[model samples]
Target: MAPPQPKAAAKAPAAPKSRVKKAKLGKARNYDLGNGIVRFSKTKMFHKTAKYKFVGKKNPKAPKTKKATIAVKPIGGEKNGGTRTVLLRRRKSFYPTQDKIKTHRHHKCFRKHERNIRPNLTVGTVCILLAGRHAGKRVVLVGVLPSGLLLVTGPFAFNSCPLRRIPQRYVIGTSTKIDLSDFKLPAHLNDAYFKKNKKSAKRSVKRKEGEDIFATKKEKYVPSEQRKTDQKLVDEAVIKAVGKREDKKVLRGYLKAAFGLRSSQFPHRLRF
Candidate 1:
């Protein structure tokens, strides 16, 4: 078997073409240089040169309307030692249409007429316990609930009493008064040496140079003159080239120069 030198292995056959037809060629690709950068992709750029077309001849000079003339009223001085002395008059509203007028008299609830009937429950009003185990015990009506329930602040036995337990003694009276005029803080709690423990906190985020906090986020109306000729193409290229790899420094440079992002600004992750 060694006598015959090993013959060179036969080369593999090339792939055969399928019967499926190829796609037809479309329009030729258009290209342009944009924003001082070489852009290989194509894009249509346009600009507005004129306003609306006039239907009639242009009028350069036109007559102006005359200004209105009116007399000024004289001021009146006060007579009763800087006191106001003017007759007040109530005016009726004039309705232009008959449909707006109503036939029925409307009753109004005047807020000024509403009186504070809540009894003088100032820090002590002797009230009787109406319900519960201590139904007869007298309690001080410390406060009154909007729902007509009285807050009777008294002994621990009556403190646990519900609104139903509030009796005639718990009834709001002016007799029971707690003198708070000479009340003072206890000696043990009056320590000026007490101080709060300090802990290091995170620094607040600082905004970029040209940012306004209260400014409404408006749709950026890019003028035709200010817009880059091939911005879309450039952005598409950048996105495609920078796919997957997220180098913070490189991204910072590109974003700062191209999109006006500040380097010291906080980093935000880009979503796909």
Candidate 2:
């Protein structure tokens, strides 16, 4: 009785309730006209009306019209069976003829994107082989092939790499170039020159009655005499040209040493 009581908290006013209006649908009616004709009318919600007029009788037992057909002869001839009837319309193809033609042209036009070699990559330039069986080997660029590959050689006598064709992308061109004014590649060393001959199947030799087939030792593969002559000719020409240069010894040493990265070395930051 001695403490004053706090007044009751005032109640918040209530929000007004929203009302939604409903649409009323009207009745539909149909009127029958003379000679199998009928008119229909329907009133929809929101005061919208639709009307339709139909012709012909509404009997479910009426026969349907048949499609036109033609008789086609069988491929095996009339002896097996007469002609079979087919619809007049042609069958649709699974794919459009235009799309088929476009696909054929796309495949025919597909070709390797040719990349231009670096400006330093010229005839007589020294390049490092970056891929294939001769990766990391330094070779001399002799010429360019019709297929855009680089024709290079290790002079056979220096690094044992003979005349070969390699893609320009797999080679890193250096600033070094040699004097090849007097040296010229042989005319026979084209793309066809490197074409490998198909070896014939080994013939099974008939042994004598007293002879044992297992006694004969298998011979090791040896390079042909023609290949030896070619290698000798190319090596002699390249070595003679290199011998005339003042830095011949240095160039020989560079080609003999294989390319490699050392610890704390980055290829991008290093000079070729």
- Output the TM-score of candidate 2: 0.51
Per-residue lDDT of candidate 2, residues 1-272 (tens digit): 58998999999888877777778765444445667454542233213332233335375877989766675755566576755666577777676657433432232332355556767888888899999888899998888765677888897778888788998889999888777767777777777777665754354466878888855444455777876887787677667778888998898899899999999999899888
The sequence of per-residue lDDT tens digits that candidate 1 reaches over residues 112-151 is: 2433434555433444454566554544443433333444
RMSD of 2: 36.0
As a TM-score, model 1 comes out at: 0.20
Question: In TM-score terms, which candidate is top?
Answer: 2
Clashes of each: 11, 0
Off by over 4 Å in 1: 1-120, 131-133, 157-174, 180-272
RMSD of 1: 42.9
Question: lDDT, candidate 1, residue 177?
Answer: 41
Candidate maximizing lDDT: 2
